[model samples]
Target: MNKFYTAQEVADKLKIKKTTVYELIKRGELSSSKIGKQLRVSEDQLSLYLNGAAKNSVSAQHHDYQPESSLLKRDYLLHSSGLIISGQASPALDLLLNQLPSTPGNLPVLQSHMNTYNGLYSLYFEKVHIACAAAAPEDVRSLVPGLSLTALLFCQYPMGFYVKKGNPRNIHDFPDLTRADIIFANREKGSSRRVLLDRTLKSSGISPESISGYRNELVSDYSTAAAVAGGQADVALGESYAVRSFPELTFLPLTQETLYLIMHSENLDTPGFQAVTETISSENFRRTLALQTGYDTTHTGEIFSI
Candidate 1:
């Protein structure tokens, strides 16, 4: 005889909410059968779903596809010039990329959102034209040994904990993450925010094992915030921009970091590169950044220290 699991049982096994399980069923991603108005998943189906998910997660972690080769076909490449941008994801960055095609030169810009380290690595290998980072220049320089890189100051924003509304857990700083009762959500290993959080915890003499859900990793800031918002996590480290999307969550400011647009020194003279820099420095772009919350545009396009 085959065993069947209810939606709640599946949620418990997967460490997610029953509602999320129902949503998966509604979307037809999870195989389910209705039995007396209750949805149930068979043991074999559950195993199949989990195995497929694990395989996909492993695949995503192992490969970092180049933008032009992946998104642009041979026919499209013949008629258009490609400019690949890889780095941290932000609303400001999205807005700027969206406006690139309308710029005077009209180059086709493709965004490959990854962590700061991977972004820098891609830039070093000429895989991307621009790499955005939140780390300091000194740290970024250490990553690319033989290449001459230039960094342009993009914007500054507050980074901190995203917690439930009304200060429920009172999670204000890094140390609070170790509390016995708190469950934390973490970003992937290469993310800048995760790097800062781990360093702070190490200096404070806190073991990652002491924190519940320390091994639970999500891909993006919005997803991290959503996990917390959906009651799957107690707190997560992210920037102020993610808070705007989750009204049920509030941001506790911990520190501020500057965002920079990095590029190879040789690419500085290219028309595509020039177009990006010009668009970022334009009055219209500045106005757009100014209107966005949690971002400081005073030095939006300033070339800080190359």
Candidate 2:
């Protein structure tokens, strides 16, 4: 007799949200049955899926990733899992991916994450070879903690608030969040924007609970910025380049944030790693990157030990 488990049970056993369980089923990654409009998974099917996933998992903590692995691991150099690059998907990054040499036959691919925090965490766990983040090295090291990774300077961009045109609410700084009339749409927890918000709120001695819409979370910069553009939100934290797509919204510069390519210190000298440095440091890369609004290429390919 096969025991059938509800979506919630599968989510619990897998340590994921219930919505994700149903999504997996929808994607045919996980098998399920509809017991009169209720989704159910059999133990055998779930077991099979877990076993297969573990064998393919780069790190169980991050999922839905392509099978490719790091730049050049000594153990699997021949059957190497290609280099995995993690970060928010951006034009510059996509260009970097295209410029990368077809190492082991064009195996490099970007493992898109929500933002810098997710990318940095993936770097810390050795899940990705090179990770990008819109976070300064010191900020990532001190405030977020965990990684002993090296930082490769990618570019610099302004970090700021996304507000409606003409700054209707007179929303100028982080303190504006404390105003009773302000409605905030926030980035997901752990994103650099979210990190900055939390850090600033704490330093200002303002209790998070005191702010209205403080708990309201938006999934990505695009979404959060869109909320402000559509008048659904009063303000959102974002890096300047990202909010450029929403022309209707106005960006109020707060500070500058540097984009960094993070990696394990031990992998610095690898040939594949060198290829990455070459691609980013090249004149063509910088020239095109500088063309993008709000990007500073002064230190585009510089590396630093973090």
Candidate 3:
């Protein structure tokens, strides 16, 4: 008979923690054999697994991992109580909280922001169950090794120059922002608005130094919109919904972008997480989001798993 290695031994060989190894077994993420009361993997089976890993078996691929119910029951212990959902400041997060079932009749929902990068790191630390971010397809690819991104919606919002509510500057599009007379406002680093501004400038072929008052950066979309509203800057890039509540600014339609919900893939099977996914697709929720803003919610809560 061939000698067999326990899960802990296999974990040591793989250089991962024993807890992760047990998690893999509980999740059915690793293969093994049951010999009476013992669970083990033969040396040959281990070598075969290593060889298959080199070739990247369909099931072994990072994107192909699926946790069965048996695994969920063993690993995910639900207490059926409160959970903290941390993300950026947005009405959508509020909408999600409102839709979740309050089992004890009333349980508070905690919301916070670490920006997108820090938010992803927070999730990796198990500090939050859900994280929200305006991630481009490329950003999604970069963030996926640690977080599994689910496409919540492609918000086709009017993202562009937030000018004073009038035809004073004649700022119609990206090019006009470079006019010698126009003073442009920008967003701070690690913000979604900042990323959009940089990309828009590159796409429009405008030199950063060429624009007047380019260094003037605001912290959030609300602040960016307010800068234009307060006449601090003639123009600034922002979303329509940000300034729609404020009558002082005008929003010009810009590019359509994707908004993603990033979370540990293990959260997908949790009851609270499942509730979030269900709420995003509900007809009532869709109607509320549509009525409040001109956001396109046609495919809200849709999953584009990679």
Candidate 4:
């Protein structure tokens, strides 16, 4: 049987600090399981992370990656001009992709799970055709620097703090997070949610360091919500619709953000883009998304400039 090690145990074995171990787990780099509200890394998981650490280093992923060059392209994307979207997995997008012509290959056809910065990065290099982002107006505009971007209003949903049932911490506002009682679950950097949280924190004049567990990150809305639900965290940011299925969590609405499907203006005239637009505009698509995801899809298919 694989032995489960505490965060401190894992940290000692790797010759790193306990906080660093939590940071690794927060980044989703080190696999761990929650043991009655405490995180533990199995022996096998630690070995797997150590094995992949060399090839998937931070330097290579964050700084050295070159998506524009032919040498470093994602082979699964197929066809230089093919439609590849980057964002959280969506069944609606899947159905739309199924309508497109398939490139016969052994590789699986899938959307890259990169959102915000990384998604826009892929788009900037033409590695991806579309990117889904939810953020403030100004921040969204800064995604693509040189390229003129055309955005299609996708969905509007409530973005807020996810707290445990009854919100025992009574985390009603941003200032409440500063209290020593609340253990926050933050989203990873570069994610649109994290960007929103950071900008909000700045504007609200709430120092991130003041919040307990503010540095304890989780990779996705669901994961963050799950942490709160599992009692691993006191508060986490997420979309109202995304965390709806996570039981034992109360979503305190802070603001609503419109998610947009953004792409380069140069590809606006392409047949692939045209099909994508058409699919989004269909009554069924808009209605289905609203009903299933609880997103405001009234303007889902409308085009706009960012």
Model 1 lDDT, full chain set: 0.75
Off by over 4 Å in 4: 1-81, 90-109
Tell me the whole-model lDDT of each prediction, alpha carbons only.
0.75, 0.71, 0.64, 0.71
Please provide, for model 2 over 1-306, each residue's C-alpha lDDT reduced to its tens digit, 9 standing for 90 to 100: 567898899999989999998667543355454343345677766775686577567555666454343421122122223565666556677667766754332443424343676556555555456778877667668633655667788888888999988898999988888899999998777677888889998899988887778888876678888888888889988877767788788889999877788887777777777778878888888988888654889999998888
* RMSD list, candidates in order: 12.3, 10.2, 15.2, 9.7
Kindly list the per-residue Cα lDDT of model 3 for residues 1-306, writing each as its tens digit. Answer: 556788789989999898776555432234344444355656654664575456456656656654653222321112212344545556666566666653223233334344566555445555445667776756755754645655555244556668888848988877787789999888766667777777778987888888887788765678877777887888888777888767987788777755667766665766666667777767888788878776788878776663
Best by TM-score: 1
- List model 4 lDDT by residue over 1-306, tens digit each: 668899899989999999998777644456554444355677766776686576457657777754445433333234322355676544445444553333222112224556577777667666566887775556666756777889887778888989877877878888887888778889888787888878878999998999888788777788888888888888888788656687678889998877778888877766777767776777877887777777788888899776
Better of 2 and 3 by TM-score: 2
Q: Ten-residue segment with the worst summed lDDT in candidate 1?
A: 71-80
The worst-scoring run of ten residues by lDDT in candidate 2 lies at: 71-80
Candidate maximizing lDDT:
1
lDDT value, candidate 2, whole model: 0.71
Model 4 quality (TM-score)? 0.71
Worst 10 residues of 4 by lDDT: 101-110
Worst 10 residues of 3 by lDDT: 71-80
